[model samples]
Target: MMLGSSNAAVDHPTSNVTAFIRRANSIMRQLSSATLHKFVVKFPLLRGDADHLDRWVSLSAASRARRIVLDLCPEVEKFGDKNQMYSFPLHLFTGGSCVGGNPCVKSLYLGFVSLNLLPLAAGGSTTTSGFTNLKQLTLHKVSIVGDLQSLLPECAVLEWLSLTYCSLHCHDLIIRQPLEQLRYLRVLQCRLQKLQLQAPNLTEFEFTNQQVPLVLGDCINMSMASVELLLLSDDFDYICTKLPVALPHVRDRLTVGTAIRTEALVLTKAGAVFANLRHLILNVTIHGCPQASTGVLRLAYLLDLAPVLEELELHMYCVSAPGFPRNPRDLDAMATSPPARLHERLRIVHMTGFHGSRGQLELAHRILWSTAALDRLIMIIGPRIKVDYYFRNLTFADTGRLVARRYIQDQFPGTVITVL
Candidate 1:
């Protein structure tokens, strides 16, 4: 009832506020404010107007709104960090019973607003059972410390929760109960030290954290999970090393589809490998490896870990990072023997930024010859610049990409090869 017309619904919350308030008053007189619910107050350019905003929150609380969304910005286009954000009076969110009023909002969404959890009751919303009955909660660009620890327990039925670009200060982010109905959770770039989840029936989860330890205690019904590492460019060591020369250098006519024979590779030190992982998308910086040629060698180690991997995508990039340019063939000369055994499960292979470097070609040769059921081999050519700039060798001049394309074309004449 607070939002007047259908066209002027949630979207136009603050366009001519006085007129809308008048219309809302008329609606309240007819239908009664007790029945008024589900209002959104999104004011982008409402500068120097805290009195009106505070009063509106008080009124919405009085109506005991079921769903409320508040989006405010001092300036129309600036974000929380760019411009001064409008702070919502958290005291106004208390239930009508708490402050001798009746705002019982069920679903609350606050964006570009500050909630000062300190100097307030522990868990911030203790004054009222205001957020207890909520089913969904979403906060964007909100800075909070210990507030979440105290608040989430009250929302017994909270199902879906998403925190994006929220500045959270804590050592351990524990999520347990009152959130029994919590099924979906997405935490992106929160910069927490650790995240511990105990939602038993949690079905779907997507977490993107660089520096946090994630522990899912009892997500029994979890069917799908995606954990993306925040790959940041760092100083890489680009020591020069001997390119991997295939032992059975030439493709044999008799054993064309067999595992390519090579020297034993001193595998890179092993880490936790996903056994159930079927598909892998990897982004590798060219200079990240100890040497340029070993970039492919590094990938071979990854393949060894995931035996059931069906689809593999490797994307390569380099930001022209400075490196420790030195000669170290022995360290590079890991006795890398392309697995003599063929991985039948490995089917599809796609490599992006394919410049047909010798090391990369060696990798392609191994996969083409080692893989038994390969259905498609795709190569994507990367940005073109002067060849002499990176390497002085004329062998890899303009033919870098051309050579990669031709190699795949020649090797996989029967299989589908896509070149982009």
Candidate 2:
């Protein structure tokens, strides 16, 4: 069951929240004791509509709804305080009055609501009655009050948990107990100072926010992890040394994204290795000529860490600014030591924003020379028009294509070269 006005419906001439609520109430009355497998409610709710909101929640709960999505967010996200937003009645479901004493709510998505877990009794002291059967829960723009740690244990069987845009005020989220069933976890835009969780069965994890200390204790089953944060050149050392320890057991893939910086970049620790990692993706932005070559060359250190990696992808953004070199070729210099042919297991290498610059060429040559098992080299020849305002050689796209077809094809006879 789905009821509510979307952003597009809000602009329609016939859209009326009052009439819509009345119609929804009438339809809900017809549902009576019918079980609801999925229930979705979306509308711009105001303080005056408290009764209607309560009735909706009560009806959904009573109907044994398995999946519920409440998106009664204001059109403009300018709620003055938590009191002005709807306070979700979590106690009713926890007390077992709702859903005929069987809390069947398996998946819940709450938006623009306030969640206060204090009223649900101390965590695991009373009972894991509320949210015990919940496998997935996502909160968007929800004001979360009280300790989230207390609430997690109640959802013992949770497999997927996501928190986005929730106001937590730099809360240190620590999960003392293990979540054995959890397989996926994602947190975005929540002001968090630190995250330390132990989800033994977790296979996928993603976090996007300010730099914070992350500790995922022994995620033995973890296969994919993504960490995107605001980073400066000084943070390079921290990323190299700390990230491996944070998500220690990532086996299949890892992706890291950082802000555009021109300072000298390097991986200080080369001892740590992602022995089981097959694919590695890097997204970075480089300032023109002066630092571009040195900055990008330093990425070889990453390849050195992922020795058995089969696929490599680089999303390089080259930005043009004042003091940019007039000739990119002048900035290119050979590494002090000759390039080593170490990546015997590497097979595929794909690159985007290939400007045919000196730095790009060096990296490409290094990969081709090292990866004896390479089967395909795909390079997307282009520039970010918005960022690359004044390239020294605007015809770098043509240059990139020419080099890929001739140089790479001639050097690596068996490998397929694709230039776009």
- Please, what is the TM-score per model? 0.67, 0.84
Residue 122 displacement (Å), model 1: 9.8
Reference-based TM-score, model 1: 0.67
**For candidate 2, what's the RMSD?**
4.1
Global lDDT of each model? 0.54, 0.71
Please give the distance, in angstroms, between residue 338's alpha carbon in candidate 1 and its true position after superposition: 4.6
Candidate 1 at residue 245, lDDT? 12
In Å, residue 356's CA in model 1 sits off its true spot by 1.9
Q: Model 1, residue 261: what's the lDDT?
A: 13
Off by over 4 Å in 1: 1-37, 45-48, 73-84, 91-104, 118-128, 176-178, 218-220, 223-228, 231-272, 283-285, 288-291, 321-342, 375-400
Error of 1 at 162 (Å): 1.1
